[model samples]
Target: MNWNQIEGNWKQFKGSAKAQWGDLTDNELTEAEGNRDKLVGKIQERYGIAQEEAERQVDSFAAGLKH
Candidate 1:
C-alpha cells in the first residue's frame, strides 16, 4: 500500500505499527498521526537508528501493507 492509503487508515495500521516497533508507545504512534516523517522520526528516536535506516524501515512497512 501507498503512504496515502496508510495515512488514511492509520487507525487500523496502528496494530501493525505496534507489532513492528514494540518499543514505541501508543501515544507516540498517535502523535505521529500517520505522518510519514513523524513516524520515521519516532522510529529513529526509539531504535537509535540512522535516519536512512528509519526511512528504509518506514518505506518497507508501507510497501508491506495492503488495501
Candidate 2:
C-alpha cells in the first residue's frame, strides 16, 4: 500500500508491524505514527540494521498490506 493509505490506516496495520518487529515497543510505534521515515528509523535503531535494510523491510511490509 501507499504511504498515504498506511498513514491513514495506521491503527489497523500497526499490529502487523508489531508482529514483524517485536523489538519495537508500543510507544515507539505510536511515536512513528505511520510515518515511513520514522518507522525506518525506529527499526534501524531497535534492530541495529543498516538504513537500507530497514527501508527494504519497510517497503516489503507496506507492499504486503496491499495483498
lDDT of 2 at 58: 99
**lDDT tens string, model 2, 27-55?**
99999999999999999999999999999
TM per candidate comes to 0.96, 0.96
Q: What is the lDDT of residue 20 in candidate 2?
A: 93
Candidate 1's TM-score: 0.96
Report how far off residue 19 is in candidate 2 (Å): 0.5
Give RMSD (Å) of candidate 2 vs. truth: 1.0
Weakest 10 consecutive residues, lDDT, candidate 1?
1-10
Model 1 Cα lDDT, one tens digit per residue, 1-67: 8888888999999999999999999999999989899999999999999999999999999999877
Cα distance off (Å), candidate 1, residue 9: 0.6
